[model samples]
Target: MALDDIRARIRAAEAAAGRPPGSVTLIAVSKLQPADRVEAALDQGQRVFGENYVQEAQRKWPAWRARWPEVALHMIGPLQSNKARAAVELFDAIHGVDRASLARRLARVAQETGLAPQVFVQVNTGAEPQKAGVLPAEADALIQECRQLGLNLAGCMCIPPDDADPRPHFQLLRETATRNGLSGLSMGMSADFETAIAEGATHVRVGSAIFGARPTERPG
Candidate 1:
């Protein structure tokens, strides 16, 4: 019933934010979770899931997709340029497009395959040195570049500083998306999704709250 609870919370957040019901998409972050956990969520009508790694998704999702054809998979972690083709082929949306090189690669893949996933430019609102997103100051250029590349530039995504308030970061992402004429805001996770929804997040990636904790050691 955790999935249902999370959905209920999302609905409440939507209502409280004065947004239309079902305005926010809940992407169950299933990366690193056990197959059974994922299946249970799928059975509960969770059709959208987020994965962090291309290889992991490739290994596990095809069979699952065969069984649940309506499923929508999203790439929510750092995406490497080398994996752009696979990510384009496998995911319905990519939420970590943070650089021009990756954007160009995605465009090339789209040209080759005649298919491209919706993409969100990742913004490092916190300006964290170690994070894998474009800095807030550089977001517009990247967004412009992505649009120029003929990619389906949907919106913006962000991971706020771990120890700081996330609402400001969410606000920055929302503002950036608005300036770029984008509507999608993939800027929330389990801990701060409500705040993100309040700040106009169109997609919230929630993991542990839905599927429980991930194992410490990932299988190769």
Candidate 2:
């Protein structure tokens, strides 16, 4: 029932945006959530799931893969260069390839692993000093550089400022992708995903809407 509700909202958002239902990909963000919950979503025919931590995903992916080999996995959190090898080995697509150094490392790791992982260049649309993305002004050049590094530059991703209207950020990303000839935009999450879909979000990372509030992590 919960999955259906989420699906209905997705459909309505697509219709409201004048986009076909098939246009958007719903990336169920299962970060901090257990595999059983993911299996439930899978039972509803959802194939793409996004994970944050490399270690967490490493623990989850193999079991899930054994059960559902065709499922697509996306790395949707801040990725450190240290985790590049594991991330390249685990995720099918990575949504947070923000830095040029990280992109180079990921490309090298992918080359060694013989896995051409799809990637999104994250842009700090809000220019938040603490965020893990290239500043908005520098995004295009960085993306071009990533392309030159032999990384599969799929598109862009962004996290809007908490107090601002996310629509403008979404609009800017969509416009940038269009102007730059990029086709993927992995923007939007549970709170403002409807607005994102309205503004041309090719991929929406929704976690709580599907899996309930994320569980608090236990300190090891």
Candidate 3:
């Protein structure tokens, strides 16, 4: 019922934004949710999923890939360079390529695997030093560098300052993607997704709104 409600809300948001029906991608953040829960959502016709940890996803998704080939997994948390090969081979796209080093590793992995999952350069739009995204000032160069490395750079992603109006950050990410000729905007989350859609988000990473809450709670 919650997933249905969230999908209804997503459709409403998309329509209100003047986007075509189903223009937005809803990534059920299945980070701490168990495999059974994910399979239930799949039964309900939800296919796109997001995972925060590589190790956890690796443990869960391989079986599903054979059974539900249409399901897509997105890496929506900070990615480690050491896990580049696993990330490339496991995910359909990653929303957390935040630096040149990580991008380079992914590129190398792609060269070896003959596959490059789609990628989005995370931007620290709020300029928070502790975050994983590239600073807004550095986003362009980083995106360019990632693209040049032959990675399938899809667009841009951002996490707005928590408890603040996320519209500005959403707008910034939208603008950055437009300037770089990128098409995807992986912005917004459980709380601000509607505003994200209004600001041109093509993908929103929603967790609690659909899956209840994280088993180990953290600030969104």
User: How close is every model to the real structure, measured as TM-score?
Assistant: 0.98, 0.95, 0.96
| Candidate 3 vs. true structure, TM-score | 0.96
Better of 1 and 2 by TM-score: 1
| Model 3 lDDT on a 0 to 1 scale | 0.91
Q: Which ranking of candidates, highest lDDT first?
A: 1, 3, 2
What is the per-residue lDDT of model 2 for residues 117-138, given as tens digits with 9 covering 90 to 100?
A: 8999898898989888888888
Residues 10-102 of candidate 3: C-alpha lDDT, one tens digit per residue: 899999988999999999998888667788888999999999989988888888878899999999999989988889989999999999999
**What tens-digit string does per-residue lDDT give for candidate 1 at 144-213?**
9998999988899999999999998998889899988999999889899999999999999999988888
Q: Give the distance in Å from residue 49's predicted Cα in candidate 2 to where it truly belongs.
A: 0.3
Best by TM-score: 1
Lowest lDDT 10-residue stretch of candidate 1: 211-220
Candidate 2 versus truth, CA RMSD in Å, comes to: 1.4
Collision count for each candidate, in order? 0, 0, 0
Give the residue spans of candidate 2 off by over 4 A.
218-220
